[model samples]
Target: MRVRLASTDDSPAVAEIYAPYVQTTVISFETTPPDAGQMAERIAATMPAHPWLLAEEAGTVLGYAYAHPFASRAAYAWSAETSVYVRPDRHRRGVGRSLYEVLLRLLAAQGYREAFAGVTLPNAASVALHEGMGFAAVGTYRRVGFKHGSWHDVGWWQRGLGGQGAPAAVRTVTDLEPSELARLLALPGERR
Candidate 1:
């Protein structure tokens, strides 16, 4: 298996992997499965500022991970939010870890100072992944999200990047407008 930056062609497969979770699980709060077009747009939007990485083997996509703005304010510019999803059949194969490794490196190279992960409750794999990757547990937001007829807690984790020579308190947090996300998403990359 290998991890690579995702492209437009990966959208449909990515959506297929996420659709079941959207329809059958509470891992993601989004209630409706996004169509391929919407998923493609999402891919486009996050590709620039953050990497949308895919884990594939023999041409089959097994998992994906990406980072996005934690907040849109310019003050939050150096901070990011992370999300990861893996094919149910492919858990524990290191795909999530591989994807996250690439995702963090890319974000750091792009000048991000810190990465934030919001792991939905009851998911020990995700929680372990973040911790294993050196993300410190900041806190958990109790019942901050609702899905599948119940409340869900979000576990927060933070990993420092870049700024090795700077004070941890000096990281900039930016509030990105939706337009910036859209624009960044449209930046060019190797198509496949």
Candidate 2:
């Protein structure tokens, strides 16, 4: 498996990977699954600023991960909310972890100071994934959302990116040197 920058061309596969969770489980709070067009728009909007990554194996997308603005406030610029979604048929194959490892590194490289993730309650796999990735359980928002005909709690986890001293303005992914970016991204084997 290899991790690479996700493009709008990858949207259909990404959307396909995400739709089942939205349709059948409380793992995602979305009531309706976005189509490929919407997913493409999301990738276009998020990039330059944040990273969207996919893990591909044998020319197929096994999973994806990304980071987005944690809040609307200007003061929240240094923090990011992260998420990962793997194909349901390919869970526990290290695909999600491969995607996240690259996503987090790229976020830090872009000057992000911290990363946060929210897991809907009772998802041992998600909670374990975040904790295994060095995130600490910060707190939980009890009964925060109603989905699947029941109330659900969201547990937030945080990971510090080791940013220190005086702050510098964050750079977009587009601002990085192409060669370096390509080098950092070529992981778990080859680049696509």
Candidate 3:
């Protein structure tokens, strides 16, 4: 599989992978599946400050991962919240891991100091994935979301990106030159 920065053109495929989670599961809290156009707008907005990465094999997108602003406050500029979604057929194939590995690396390169992920309770696979990637369980919000006729707990995990001392001004992924961005995505260990 190959990992790369996602483009607006990949929105439909990404949306397809995500629609099921929204429609059939509490994995995502979004009540309605976003259309391709909405996904495109989201990609455009988030790509300015963070990365939206896709894992593909034979030209088909298998999964995607991305980071977004953790909070609106300026004090939170060095942190980000992350999410990943994989095609249902592609589960257990390392698609999520591959996408997240690249996503974390890209976030670090973009100057993000920490990355956080929230997993809806009872999701063993997602919890394992985050822990395997070095995230520490921070806390859980009990019955934080009501979905699918039930209340769900949300567990939070955090991973430090090795930034130390006073943070330098954070740079958005878009602030990098095209070649630099390409090189970071193409880094030797980034793909599965």
Candidate 2's displacement at residue 118, Å, is: 0.6
Global Cα lDDT for candidate 1: 0.78
Q: What is the lDDT of candidate 2?
A: 0.90
Where does model 1 exceed 4 Å of error? 165-192
- Candidate 2 scores a C-alpha RMSD against the true structure in Å of 1.4
Worst 10 residues of 1 by lDDT: 167-176
lDDT of 3 by residue, 21-130 (tens): 99999999999999999999999988867788989989999999999999999999999999999888889988888888878877888788999999999899999999
Query: Candidate 2 lDDT, tens digit per residue, 1-192?
Result: 888899899999999999999999999999999999999999998887988999888999998998899998999999999999998889998887778888888888889999999999999999989999999999999999999889999999999987797668999988999987987687756654
Candidate 3 versus the native: TM-score?
0.94
Which ranges of candidate 2 are over 4 A from the true structure?
188-192
TM-score of each: 0.83, 0.96, 0.94
The C-alpha stretches of model 3 lying farther than 4 A from their native spots are 177-179, 187-192
Query: How big is the positional error of residue 47 in model 1, measured in Å on the Cα after superposition?
Result: 1.9
lDDT of 1 by residue, 1-192 (tens): 767668778899999999999899888888999988999999888666667878888999999888888999878877889989999999998788878877776676567888998877888888899999989999999999888888899888999976665433331112344444333323234222
